[model samples]
Target: MVKRTAEQRVLLDQIKQIADGLGQTLAPFCEVVVHDLLEPEQSILAIHNNLSGRAVGDPTTELGQARITDPDYPQVLANYANQFADGRQAKSTSIGIKDASGNYIAALCMNVDLTLFRSLQMAMGQFVQTATDGPKETLDPAGTDALRDRIDAFAARLATTPRALKTEERRALLGELKASGLLDVRRAMETVAAHLGVSRAAVYSYVR
Candidate 1:
């Protein structure tokens, strides 16, 4: 066990405060820790959010040891892959803090559990999943008798007969037909007027 100087102790305390704030802000899913590099055997000075079930006075992790033992270890390791003891995936960021003498004195670390995110991803995938082998039919208006079928289907969806459809409903249906290029078909207006029990002139006004 190494002895911590007064300056290092103060620095660790301040870092602990930051870790606590970050832990609360990132709540429930993230664990924040402050490691006292001066004492590798009891490196963990504080832990917040507690996702990994680790505690204060825990020994330094392998990465912490690297920072302690190596003079050239990377100062910031961001978003690196990690895992919890129970096999939950984690994303971690470790930042090594150096004292005025250029010696690594502490480390501030954050571990984010990916379980919730991964579960949500899977749920969304299942939600959007569609059956692969059902009703390979097309609503393409250009198919034989398809335009009239589409109008009838639209009225059926509204729980009414085409000839009994309200004025707004007819106008909306004509808009749908116009949008599908079905109105471009020969005698399309005549077909629509006949189906809705209206004259071609009324169909033209609806199309407008």
Candidate 2:
């Protein structure tokens, strides 16, 4: 085991403080850890958020090995992808701390689980779906003029112009059109794209 100097101890304390702040700020999804390189067998000095099922006395990771064995190893590796033991996706960043003699002494690591955000995305998608054959009126005869009127009405409901509608709004409008069977008309996508000042592909993307 390596001996830690006073300066090394102070550096570890400061890094642990940062880990605590990050853990609180990104709570539930993020995990922050500080490792003591001098004691690789029991390197984890602190762990926050506790997402990975690890504890304060967990052993060092492969990253810690690089820091202990490689004098010229990089000090920081930011925004790289990682995973947990249970196979959940994560985005991680690791920072190596060294003392005045260029000896690696400690490390600060952060891992953020992305499953929550992905689940939220799926929920939003489901919420936005509208049922076909609902009571809403369909476009009469499915012509360009009728399509324009439908688009204008939907845009008005949102207090925005058709040309100013965002992607989500456009998608919602397409949903309405599909429910009304207006999207089944010949050249319907082309007509809508022309009215929205966007490409035909962009209009199709909303439905797809």
Candidate 3:
């Protein structure tokens, strides 16, 4: 496993704090992971901080290979990092800080139970309702924080779309499987397909 940076340690503490304070507010059972860089081509991930456990079968995520390699790709992770650094948000609901080059500086994400949030939203009880409908948020705090602004904006775009996963995200998932010694490509595709509600073909399309 790779060691986190000095600044990243700060983010790690924040992750623990958030997990303690608002972890329940999250959907459920969904662990949040944070990374600094997405080296999809090389299957390398630079994790800054994460609350998601590395228990029996957990590996880091490296799901940005395809899009990261494409210069014209719409949702490249590097692009988001740059935009966030420039104080401009990207399209997805990514909750973290990234350098101009897409290296994660600081971030906070919660493992959420989609079903519960949906049910709670349907009930429309005391949950705070924004102009948007969902409750997922991205935060880039101070203290050695390297992530730029607009990360929240990128995360918002991610939240609005139903199937808007980026190459980095897919690559991240693949890395997780590989590191766990469970890199059965075919099985991985099937499992990811089931989780994303996409077809095995789509999973292969991104991962391959």
**lDDT (Cα, 0-100) at 102 in candidate 2:** 90
Worst 10 residues of 3 by lDDT: 140-149
Q: Looking at candidate 2, what is the lDDT of residue 66? A: 86
Residue-level lDDT of model 3, residues 56-175, one tens digit each, is 123323333323344333332321221123343222223544435555444333333344445777888655556666776655223111111122233355573224556676565545
* lDDT (0 to 1) per candidate: 0.90, 0.91, 0.42
Model 2, 1-208: lDDT tens digits are 6676789879988988998998899898889999998999899999999999999888999999988999789999998989999999999999998889998899999999999989999999999999887897866445767789999999999999999999999999999999998887778988899889999999989998
Compute the lDDT for candidate 2: 0.91
Which candidate do you rate higher for TM-score, 1 or 2?
Answer: 1
Q: What is the TM-score of each candidate against the true structure?
A: 0.61, 0.60, 0.28
Candidate 2 lDDT score at position 104: 89
Sort order, TM-score high to low: 1, 2, 3
Candidate 1 residue pairs that clash? none
Name the candidate, 2 or 3, with the larger lDDT value: 2
1-208: candidate 1 lDDT, tens digit per residue: 5677788878888998899899999998999999988888998999999989899999999998998888589999999999999999999999999887788999999999999999999999999998898778766344437778999999999999999999999999999999998888877888898889999999999978
